[model samples]
Target: MKVAVLGLDCATPQLVFDQFKSDLPNLSRLMAEGIYGELESTHPPITVPAWSCMMSSRDPGELGCYGFRNRKDHSYNGYSLANALAVQEPLVWDYLQEQGLRSILLGVPQTYPPRPILGEMVTCFLTPSTQSEYTYPAALKDEIERISGGYILDVENFRTDNKQAILDQIFEMTRRRFRVAKHLIAHHPWDFFMMVEMGVDRIHHGFWKYFDREHPKYEPGNPFENAMREYYQFVDQEIGEILSLLGQDCAVMVVSDHGAKKMVGGICINEWLMKQGYLRLKEAPSKPTPFSKVEIDWDHTLAWGEGGYYGRLFLNVKGREPRGQIEPGDYEKVRDRLIADIQAIEDPAGRGIGSIAMRPEELYRATRGIPPDLIVYFGNLDWRSVGSVGYGAVHTFDNDTGPDDANHAQHGIFILQVPGRTGGHNHDDLRVYDVAPTILDLFGVSISREMQGKIIR
Candidate 1:
């Protein structure tokens, strides 16, 4: 069967069906005709590993990528920021190509420096610039630029103070992305086609405050209050247009890597670690310094956290790190202690923070590179971890990147439809990893033995 997959980053089932069902006719129609549900995302759900997990049908451990920024090795001082090149496993598309089935991939994260495929490829957000060779065939670059004016890898400077400018860029980027996608759909020959629209994620991050009534900084009558809804509607319309391009026999699926939600605030994890005597600095700076810049007193430091949507705590194990402190036999002892302490942390309001801590090995089949001793979700994903020291207080109002209104939620969207099929169903137990195996099953491709997720069928 011909399959067309649309990846909508951060598209949540709650927002799509409960909040804006009426505004999304195309999606609503698909829901009525197909299997729809909440697709559970990866633990500490963020973009980098989430998408990679979906594409590979493997958890972060098997993928060996935990986040956008990864420890380069077992060395504590070295790290490598993830790009498309960082994924070590064979992607689903690679499997399809091996089977002699042609496919076209566009804007899928972890696809930058586009690998050679049986068909066309256009890289996603991780691409450094449009000037780089973003397409697989090399010549497809000129064709994409000619069709969409220029290929938009992603909107730059998403954290700008100018909300309107960010919105405008989102619109332009969405328009270009869909335009290119449409051109490819109509022109390219393929058994499988997939593309991801990052604008949905971008707009949510940029304007969630205006859309979310419960947001602390929300203004009820703001001009951009309907911005997120309007963008989803625009996306729905684009979906309809793409649907019209496909034949009736084709199968269609719409999925998201992870969902989005309002970010309450940030918890300064490093400061908390310091207060708990687990971390130390050479000299306290007058201002906050990044993790890399902070002169860490490793001799005294037992654990340190690197901040993101979730917190990552690394233990200075005696043999693993350069200046290790925690004894090899005490690894589990230190880890369990840190987990207990972090979980017991309370907010300034004298309330439990609702944190969840897990070792990387517990969640994945296998782990590589420098895995965090503990992965933490403060306030159950509402509050991000802030690594900067010298913030003085445990709570902060702004993200390290800038004024981000939302954080990654644990559930994204999953909708599947076969033309002429009726009696649709909804499930809450589906997961991101299930998508790859389901797609493979639909196309008669054998599921990989290494995949942890079961085929939805």
Candidate 2:
């Protein structure tokens, strides 16, 4: 049986399986006629490493890709994009290709700088633009453009107050992406096909406040209140159309990298570190400044952190970093104290927000490639980690990057429908790692010993 994966980035189980269930006929049908449940996301659960982890059945530690940006080495400024180049492990398609099977990949995260595949490929949003070689055969770029009438890599400036423009751009981008997918499925030869629609993620981040009453910034009776529901309905329609193009022999699976939840506020991690004396600056900035641009006093600083949906705290240990402050022998001792202090952090009202800091070695099977000293989830990920300093306080409703209302949740939706199989069975043990092994199992390929997840069956 052939496998087809429909990836909906940031598709929340709460919304898909509960809130908007009736509106999403296609998705509901799949859930009713298949195995469906919440799939646990990777630790930190952002798109880049999460999707990469799902495709390779490898933990972020094994891939050495903790987030969208990773410490290239021990140097302060030595960070690199967690792009396709960072992933050396073979993905599901790679294993299938070895058995002379062809696969189609479209807009899957971390696939930028599209490498040579045995089948056709269209890279993800990380592509510089269509101007770059985003297709495997190079010549396929023109055909893709012609078929989709100028493909869209991503919605530009999605984090904007201009909700209408971003929403329109998102719909158009999704429409074009699915249009291209339909063309490929009908015209191209393939055994396994996977395409990720980014609109779900974009819509949630851009408009969650309007719909979610739980959002701190939420305003009831807003114009865009139904924006997320409408988008999900559209996506379901698109999925229905795509299903029409597939033969009965094909098995379908819908998955997301992670779910979405209302973001209460931002935790200025660097500013908090400064207050804790873990991070020291050469001079106080007159205004908010990015952590990378600020003058850091490495000699006095014990730890500094970079922020996103999660926090990556790096310790400056003697003999490890230039002008390192923490003694090599005291690394774990200092880290333990910091972890305790971080988890003890409270809300403005002095109530605990349930923050926790974890050591890399404790979470992953193996620590690889300059892993952060501690991984943090501020307020259990209800709050984002703001890297900008000079914020004056630990919590801010305003985002350092831009306006965003949602944060990634720990569980994403997963639905699998196999031909000639019983439907409506739900399993709760799904993990991002299981996807790769399940794909290999579907194709009758041997599960590699290096893969960290078990087959879903």
Candidate 3:
């Protein structure tokens, strides 16, 4: 079986099917030709933990990941491989390698410092802030260096506050990735060909308004989002083209890690945390002259928030935490207490909001990969968690500008976008996690006895 896994960051199952059911004459036929549905994710259904779990087949807690950030050792300043390293448990690739099957991974996150990668890979999504050493897949340094353009690019650099520019950038990257995918697939005969279209998520965050055309943030005449109906069409064309090249007998599967949805309103969790005595922002002393801004004592700051990504409540464990306030054997207790407190937290006017929090135990049960150091749930997160995120302050600053428009916010309610799949979509929905085990199942590989998720077949 040859599976083509298309991971659209923050793509809701419905978004995928709804936008393309008829538009994608190709994928629609593929659906009839195979299996499809809304796939449920473990709780605290954020990306970092969810994607990692899908790849590794291990629960979040065991994988040692909390969110995109390693709160235990660092803050959410940038992506770090520290947590990835802690995921000593084996991955789907390891099993594939042992079985002598080759696979291809494109632009997947947390797979960086990519080692033990079973097949050919080109590292991606490596941000400018990432430590040079942490971004490269140590084993494939030569391959990455050989790519026409290095494996990593400052993707956000292509983004802009203008929707058209953002769309152009998305298409540009998509083209680059398509070419790369073709190269890898042709150069190496592989069992699985996986692609993560980071652009789709970026597009959703910046253009969810396009889908509805009624939100306060909606932009008119913004060619990209306003014409988003074509985005999926374009992607479908890409899929059709890829399919044309595949062997007819191979079974095909299209999977997205998480679905995307438009954000309702911003929640100043840190601001809320400050009111709850959970976070304290260090004050800047004396107004500074122009061109010279004040500094943030990241070291001294207590409980900071990083925009919409994880929607997490990270406690600064060092100097700022209440002395002995959260002690040993009480991690779960503190976690529960935090979740409860955050749940009770209300917006300034108190009109009943749609968010919740999670304890380590709840978080532990919620996922099969690294669990966030702290569990935070936003709004109903009907599917269990909010979408992607970006860098921003607790309350101020209008990220309505720059790449901030594309700052996270994709994953949401979806597993499938069928007439009956809407709210009822559940374990019954087509799942992305099932991709690995299903392939393993077909090959006669024992689904790892320790696997948290079940076989797709």
* Over 4 Å off, model 3: 72-86, 116-118, 127-154, 219-225, 281-306, 315-337, 347-349, 365-373, 381-432
What is the C-alpha lDDT profile of model 3 across 134-194, one tens digit per residue? 3224544444435425443324644355767767777777766776676676677778667
What is residue 19's positional error in candidate 2, in angstroms?
0.3
How much lDDT does each candidate structure score?
Answer: 0.88, 0.92, 0.55
Which candidate wins on lDDT?
2
Candidate 1 C-alpha lDDT tens digits along 333-362: 888888888788888888987888999888
Q: What's each prediction's TM-score?
A: 0.98, 0.99, 0.77
**Model 1 C-alpha lDDT versus the unseen true structure:** 0.88
TM-score of candidate 1 on Cα atoms, chains taken together = 0.98
- Clash counts per candidate, in order, are 0, 0, 35
Query: Which stretches in model 2 have alpha-carbon errors above 4 Å?
Result: none
lDDT of 3 at 438: 68
